[model samples]
Target chain A: MIEIQNLTKKYGQIVAVDNLNFTVERGEILGFLGPNGAGKSTTMNMITGYLPSTEGTVKVSGYDIAQEPNEVKKRIGYLPENPPLYTDLTVDEYLSFVSELKKVERSKREQQISDIMELLKITDVRKRLIRNLSKGYKQRVGFAQALIGNPEVLILDEPTVGLDPNQILEVRNVIKDLRKEHTIVFSTHIMQEVSAVCERIVIINKGKIVAVDTPENLSKAITKNSRFTIKIAGVKASVIGALKAIDGVKNVEVSDKVEEDVYEYIVDSDKQVDVRKPIFFAMAKLGFPILETKEEELGLEEIFRELTTKNIVVSTESDNSKQDASGEAPEEDDQAEEKEVE
Target chain B: MLSVYKKELRTYFYSPLAYVLSGIFVLVFGIYFLTQTMSKAGQGIAQIVFGGQLFFASFWLVMLIPILTMRVFAEERKNGTEVLLMTSPISVPQIVIGKFLAAFTVFLTMTALTAIFPIIISISGDLVISNTLSSYLGFVLLGASFVAFGLFTSSITESQIIAAVLGTVTLFFILLIDQLKTLVSGIFLKIINQLSLYEHYKQFVQSVISLKDIVFFVSLTGMFLVLVMIVIEKRRWSQG
Candidate 1:
């Protein structure tokens, strides 16, 4: 329901968000995964029409953000990184104010406000001044403010930053429930949040998109081989030799000895190849009994670290090479010394 | 725009600061009424309304307006709530005009309370109703212009203290520009004298509701309000 093309934001000499192009389909929950300063918030602000991009265009449901911002803004409910709140007002007062600002129909304003309060579980503290509420409560109130008009699009930045573990789970469930009605694009550095709630993930680093895919596909795409850990009732050398000799087996290494007779080995097979049937037949022929076997898949955390860290390493290596070529190599030597000290 | 106007109006009534400001506002006007009319019984009610007493009360306006308008935009920017307002479907001009009218309404309400002074004078002696009405008109126009100036200053910064300080200093200089006319000469002196903010009120206080004076205050208020809109609009372009 949203399309952004060549979105770039520059503050004088510093480019905050550079040529970001992405889209969110209707009713899709797209997770924006990035480290801090990855331009996630800047991109969101530009999409919500809060900040004008230096050179870009955002279209929300066929309306251009620059040309028809009012229509675009009417459809977006943005929860900024720092919840924008007037602390002097009560929770109910703030929500109603937001409802009015969002221009909810007069007949449905009260019902919408109460339903949002109920959804966020903030009804008990509705009468309390926002400044007096706890941080988690304040964050929930911010969420409620965004949900006031029941907008078609919800853009949340770090929706669960300071909440307790239970609250985080509650918020995730609420967002999942919201996905049935609204298209969502939320940003967070927490890998588990994306895996739990988002259907697709877009990983960004240093103002550029690094990868975009479903969580499962992202993890599977990171490595060329499918790994398997198997324990067999056989000598380690024979089991390793037999596993390596399989047609689809790429590599095998001894991992552990569970007992005097049983040994565990990690086996790597060619991509999209399943070695279980061949291993079982071969083991039967060799008189080796199989005890346990399980496939290993990469998790979101590993995929994220691999993607973000690779960019850092590549950039730093290029920087070091450039410094060496320029005869300004002492900085790299100093960095090496610092690394050694660590 | 209506939403912002109503929210700001409610904030004025809900905050204790507004009450304190209104109380001090009435007290200052009451003192001026007592000294300028009650102590001297022979002066016409028109004279009291048009006197140096009401003119000096404009000084109190220069001091009190910052309290009303300093937090209009500055507080929102500081607390980051400008995000909510700016991102709403409302345009920048709507936000500026909504806030300007809110502050001006509070100033108008405070000045309206001084109507009791004119009523008391009318009951006790011969009061020229036309002059009284005209003077009240002048006071409203003057207060509205000062509020516009304060709101303009508030829009330029995120610190309420700086907005208030700059607003007070700028209005104070405008209030004293008439005094500086004596130091200059010829056409320059006349131009500076005419530009004096308080000088415009002289015609209104004398029971003269000339279109020239009304246009002067209205245009001055409009000028500052337009500047505020420009400042807020520029912010959208420069911010990322």
Candidate 2:
């Protein structure tokens, strides 16, 4: 188990991590989510004892990292953003060195080195210097280095960044296999990869955590208006006419025209409202047959955007209301009253 | 400590670096030995031991210092292997001492191979056994200081080029401290010049078994290794 409490890292005037708090229980795979420069790598560096936090504590399996670094280091395996590999040594020789530094018994070092290479499927390249291996194989060699000493915690920073599609799946599968025993904290900017591999997501933005929730709940909660987009082979006026007349449709508008006859329209409804059946019937009655009616899913991407951007949106109405009451910008009071309900 | 020592030592032999540097040392001294001994210039046993040890001691240290110690920590940081060492359970001193021992072992092997010079001189003429023994001891002490300088250079930078240049330059400065004493007439300059590694190696080269010279060489080696340890410790504070 890894417990990070109020972890903050400040580099001069800029704060890279701002009082961030999160935890990974045994057997939990947490997807560390953030945009570029969102402190994902900094946070991982702190947890793995690569860099120290300006404030707060990181405890690995009940051992305080700062107080007992060797204890914490013994329990955690870190693969930094760049794989820290020795290019001169062969893979087998490098692994043996790491195994010894990790305090593996001399008797079990050989067997353990072989087992880790077998696990990552790098046994074929074990005799080769790491400098000669391709990017994917080098990454696997790095992964093999982490698996030495069989530490319970694994912190991988962008594990599959440069891998091919097939290699990405294979690496994902290997991480999943390790999930049964190890507490994994893997960071990535790709949301789809998080959804595929992570059981929970902690989205970070601008040095602060925006949200922490299950992927399904985040997707559902952030889809506020239940909006639907449909492309139909009909006139814009008729499509809007058909959708606005539905019982549960809150608003309808023709968004774009794709072809001479096909139109793209947006339909907004109340939360939990399904207007596909009503729109199909109304369009059929008007003699404009519905070509497509599919609900637009508010995926992890949208949820991430909403959570990260919520702070800066001042709503414009609040500004106007304050100005109208205080007699500031009094000439715009009439316009402000017009938009009071906005 | 043992593990890192083994890794560093294996790295020396696995690559061509160790053989190349060691070959240069033997080759330089081989030319010197052939001219002095085989060409009949090393007529007396005393002359053979005195000249052989002096030639081997200086050049062996100059070439081996840069090649053997060039990559100790600087290369690890550049090639991205410092993360493995820092995150491992081993402490900083263990790593410093381990790398030091590894580089010193290579120096010892180089020194051992030059044993052929003394044996070759002995085969042709009667050997001045006592003088030959002190000359070998003198070479060993000087080489130990070179190993210390190699590691100290490696610790100061992440670029091996810079490390090699810095180590060679620092050794050169210490060697030329004698010239400074000659140029200046101050008492302090004379005292500082006495701290030079070559200045202290002089007494033992003439087969004078002075304890003060032994102390000077050993203390210089110990001081540099400790300074390397302090620099490594200070780096962790920056991370914190």
Best by lDDT: 1
Checking candidate 1 for backbone clashes, the offending pairs are none
lDDT of 1 at A245: 87
Candidate 2 versus truth, CA RMSD in Å, comes to: 8.3
Clashes of 2: 0
* TM-score for candidate 1, residues paired by index: 0.89
Per-residue error for A177 in candidate 2, Å, reads 1.4
Q: How accurate is candidate 1 locally (lDDT)?
A: 0.83
**Over the stretch A62-158, how does candidate 2's per-residue lDDT look in tens digits?**
9998999899999888887788888888998889888988999999999989988887789999999988999999998888888889999999988
Model 1 CA deviation exceeding 4 Å by range = A234-288, A312-342, B37-51
- Complex DockQ, candidate 2: 0.37
Error of 2 at A250 (Å): 6.0
**Local accuracy by lDDT, each model:** 0.83, 0.78
Among residues 3 or more apart in sequence or in different chains, the pairs in candidate 2 whose N, CA or C atoms overlap within 3 Å are none
Q: After TM-score superposition, what is the CA distance of residue A193 in candidate 2 from its true location, in Å?
A: 1.1
What are the chain A TM-scores of the candidates, in order? 0.86, 0.81
